[model samples]
Target: MNEVMDVIRLFLPLIVVQLLLMSVALFDLYRRVSVRGQKWVWVIIIIVINLLGPIAYFIFGREKSSEY
Candidate 1:
């Protein structure tokens, strides 16, 4: 039980961050008009690739806005 707690303590922050990233990615995906790839493909990547998936989506999936 102590070992489980220790492990959880060590990884809990990372898990939380990953969940946050996933949520943000999914929310953005839902709201955006266009992404660099197809919506379903981005969804697959976000759901399947774990931490890197959402990071990749945030970094590369979004199309640049000319308005900015």
Candidate 2:
């Protein structure tokens, strides 16, 4: 029905946004965990504490050579 289609249209963008955010978080977690000197425990931190995971990565996970 037209009403169902309209609801889907409205919800699609929200679904896309959530997926994008989740992807970014996962990528950040992988990068942080792969650091050479750092322990792998941070990956657990990221998984159990979602917001803190990315924040810790940004604060502590940056390689000396890369800005991101």
Please give the range of 10 consecutive residues that has the lowest summed lDDT in model 1: 59-68
lDDT of 1 by residue, 1-68 (tens): 99999999999999999999999999989988888879999999999999999999989999897321
TM-score between candidate 2 and the true structure = 0.49
Off by over 4 Å in 1: 66-68
> What are the root-mean-square deviations of the candidates from the true structure over C-alphas?
1.9, 5.2
Residue-by-residue lDDT tens digits, candidate 2, 11-56? 9987676555546766765655255345456555555665566556
Error of 1 at 7 (Å): 0.3
Measure candidate 1: CA RMSD.
1.9
Q: Which candidate is the best by lDDT?
A: 1
Reference-based lDDT, residue 26, model 1: 96
| 19: Cα error in model 1, Å | 0.2
- TM-score (C-alpha, index-matched) for candidate 1: 0.91
